[model samples]
Target: MSSVHVEPVIAGAARETWLGGSLKAFREDPLALLCELHRASGDVAKFRLGPKKLYAVFNPDMLKEIMVTKAEAFCKGGTFAEIKRLTGEGLVLSEGELHKKQRRLIQPKLTRSHINRYAEQMVASTLAHLETWGDGQERDLAVDMMKITFDIIARTMFSYDSKHAQDQIARAFDSINHIATRKIRALVKLPLFIPTNENREYIQALRVLDDTVYGLIRQRKAESSLEREDLLSVLMRATDESSQEGMSDEQLRDEIMSMFLAGHETTAHSLTWTYDYILQNPNVEEKLMNEWKHVLNGRRPTVNDYPALTYTQNVIWETLRLRPSGYVTSRTALQDVEIGSLQLIKGDTVMISPYPLHTSERYFDDPLTFRPERFEQDRMKELPQMAYFPFGAGPRSCVGQHFAMLEMVLILASIGQQYRIKRSSTQGALIPEALLTLSPKGGLRATVHRL
Candidate 1:
């Protein structure tokens, strides 16, 4: 541990104000504001929301202390507390013992062996969706990727095959995403019971989401004797160590909803960004095509084929590095602890933004350029730990990382092998919007052609 300084005068004090210093700017454009703070004040900077103190740590070593070494001293706070309305007490939102137990039960289902079983379904679902697109057709690749990933998650998680069911789930999630965006940026926190239009829409979306998830739970329970390989089955059969009991109906709903939201949205946005970058960089696109042709040779990608698709994997990694959907994550200190030189008091908040870190010149060469080659093994090994955590780090890191990677690689390979996508003439420069996830501002418009 580095020697700590006690009660150091917080840097970036000039950025504060009488009423929530930097709060307005943060709400407007968090990424830009945080980046400015980093540039002006170096690695560790402190500001305030009224009297409440907040710290933004940009150094990877300090971030590791918060996420790994002394993670137990922190709890999910700020945005995560707000997200509980949508995720309930599922693994993503839970803390302490509950989080540990939920993670324990759910972890087995997301292991590589379990996720590998879904690879065929992932490719098949992607191909089925691609088949609906006509050659030379213009489409919003962002929207298309969302639908494709949603369908794949639906099938692999619950054996849900109905287009109607998939559409309903997608629509509900859309509403939820919108509400989350509003809530996160709203100057005044509105109570859900106020019956505002946004509140009404949020409730309605939750109703639809609940109906679909609970219906699946009931249907599964009715056929308990049947053997299934889907995630729902594994979760239903899992028993806690102490109680030897599986999750209740409501518990199942929470876990299923968490997986559905976390599983698809990030992966979809990542794929969308990947396509956006590939269209902008011709050389990268050519390399990706060459890799696809040489590896699978026109055959659709299977789980076995992913190991050979090195460039395709690198493309996904670079996309995540450049445009991580979960761009920033927050945690509140549960105890007074020393992080590097500063003393953090209990209840003080810490914000770790991967967006700025990924683009920092100190961490990477030519940070803004779209160069997938930076992810090459030797180069990657040279970078600092926690410097590139799109899925986060430590205990609360994304549980479905393997599943997401496989799905993205297979989807890219399958689509790239059959189609060449280019930006539409009407589409403008990519402007990233920091909503619930970092999505392209107006969606990614592109034209697709069969190769």
Candidate 2:
């Protein structure tokens, strides 16, 4: 009998020949490497990150299969594990039954009805932040955006408005975000118990955040009889339908930290890029301004104006496509599964990046160009659902999507109504540095022009 030779289905094959597989390429420029791989391999591309196997899924159908249809088979693991260190068992990191229960409990707070109540506060916060800006004065919109979003989240969610407390929380959160981003991709990671300088700093940052969050929770608990409109108050009052149980203090802390990160960082990055792209494309700004004029008519935008503000919403959509806050999200296979022709065994990691898909020539005409008209009603109807999901899709989709959309629209409208931000001559091109959230590197310096 002749000896039979068979090649392994997925393990040994690698697109790159380097010792570290795609890690070296990914480390250099993650977005570029993923885009290259998608172009070369089509929907599904198998590669390695160090010793781990990763499948880059580019097609809408394949993405749907992983994120929606077979979502249970692919759990939030790997990179999320790193984030869990900061967020604990919050909605973003929790898995299985715990995740479902948490979602059920939190869903009501983010409902459109509840989110509508926050509209006035969102615009007020933006206007308040704009007071710090001067006409013709150069300012970093990145910092300004962060400050405004942070202020909004603080006032709307926690009902905490002390500037000193907000500043302390902001500083500690920034420290944690910086250290967590560095540690997420590091080849070697030391445990928290280890007394390394980096570990010490990370722990201290965690301590500051915990202290602040715990203080808020305690204050809310003491004021249980007092009815409030804030999210924290709602969450404190929330009870599970099945168990009739409320969240614990630790659970509250985790969810608060998750909210602080998600509610602020992502929207701030989106607005910063919105201005960057708007400044780069004068036509876009003109259209946006025209839409605001027609819709709002010199009045501040209300939640009711969203349907009328089509072009303004379109600009936000286009910006999200070009620069998504959650640029690349991943999941690990919990069991053997067949995604098209590829057989992914248990523990295999699948990366689905909207960046490559959004920028691809196949799905978009002149993909590199910034044209918000592509999202017009007729055009958008023809596009696939998975092709443009800035807030993500499926059961694991962002629960705060409604809240975020309304807040972004209000802020953008409020800012554009009073001022036009142009890039400063001293600042170079805006560069994206993919941290926990995709943020503009070196901040976005621009001059505020009063209308």
Candidate 3:
């Protein structure tokens, strides 16, 4: 176990104001605000948002204490609490024994063997979606990334194949994500019962989500035999070792919904950001094509090829390091616990944003530049465990990490094999929309050239 030592709080850490301390800055630009706070203060910067006390944790050892060593003393807080409205008691929001059990139940489905099976669908889905594109066609690459990832997750996880149904769920996700992001940054939150236009839109979106998910559950349950290999079927068939019973309909819904949100959303944004970086660095793009050619040899990617695709994997890691989709995650102290020398109250929220830690000069040389070689084997072993955690760390880390990684590699290689997506010269500087997920602002407009 790693021991956390208290480092002296820097004299000029960002402080809370009489009202909403730092909330205005956070709302205007969270990424910039977090970066500023870390630069101004050292590791443990204390600030505020309205009545909430927030400690922006940047030190890797302290992060380990909060996420791993003393993890039991904290529960999901900040935007995670707000997301529960959509996720319910899903893996992302659940706590204590329930979280443990849910993790046990779902972990097996995302194992290496299961992820290998998912790769086939991932490639097929990408290829199928690619058929819709043409040589020299211009498209919003962000939208393209989302649609293909949505399709991949739908087929690979649930065996769902209805394009119409997929589109409906995608639209609902858009509405829900928009409202959720607004609520996260909103100084004042309106209760769901108020039925304001936004509230009503939120409610309707929830209705659509619940209806679609439950309808799938009901439809799956009604099947004569539930022996399929998809994640949904496997989950439906899994029995708790202690209880010798399966999950309830509601439990399945929560897990499935969790997967739906985490499975596709993070990967899509990652691909978007990866391409954005690739467009910025021509040498990186050429290296990627060379590696793909050497390993894949103008052929489709497979699970067997993963080991040989080291550089390709490094690109994904570098992209994730630079623009992690879930840029910030938070945890509230579950009790009066002492982390390092700082005493945290039961409800004090500790915000952990990966952007600062990932981009810090302490972690990487020339941190602002996009360099996949930084993740090369020998260099990776020297970094701290908590450094460069794009998918996060500890027990509460992403459940479908393997699934996401393989999916990213296969999709990137597949796309690179057949087409080159370049940024449009007319498209001005891209901005990072620091919503729930960090994505390219106004979408990434680019031309797709067939190779």
Q: Who wins the lDDT comparison?
A: 3
Task: Give the clashing residue pairs of candidate 3, or none.
Answer: none
**Is candidate 1 or 2 superior in lDDT?**
1
What is candidate 3's lDDT per residue for 360-447, written digit by digit as tens?
8898887777778887767977988898788888999998888899999999999999999788988876678777788678888899
After the best TM-score superposition of candidate 1, give how far the Cα of residue 151 lies from its true spot, in angstroms: 1.2
Q: What C-alpha lDDT, on a 0 to 100 scale, does residue 316 get in candidate 3?
A: 88
lDDT of 1 by residue, 139-163 (tens): 9998899889988999998898747
In candidate 3, position 178 carries an lDDT of: 83
**Residues 1-451, candidate 2, lDDT per residue (tens digit)?**
1111111112222356556777766655677778888767888888887777788899888788888888999897877777887799988888999899888877888899988988898999889888888889999888888888988888888898745676677677778777887777666778889998988888988898888889988887887374886777777877877788888898889988888889888998998988888877777788788888888888988889987887777778888988889988899999999887778899988987898888877888877777787777768567777887888889999998888888888999999899987878888777777777777888888899999
lDDT of 2: 0.81
**Distance from true location, Cα of 152 in model 3, Å:** 1.4
**Candidates sorted on lDDT, descending:** 3, 1, 2
Model 2 poorest ten-residue lDDT run: 1-10
In Å, residue 191's CA in model 2 sits off its true spot by 2.3
Better of 1 and 3 by lDDT: 3
Could you give the C-alpha RMSD of every candidate to the true structure, in order shown?
5.7, 7.7, 5.0
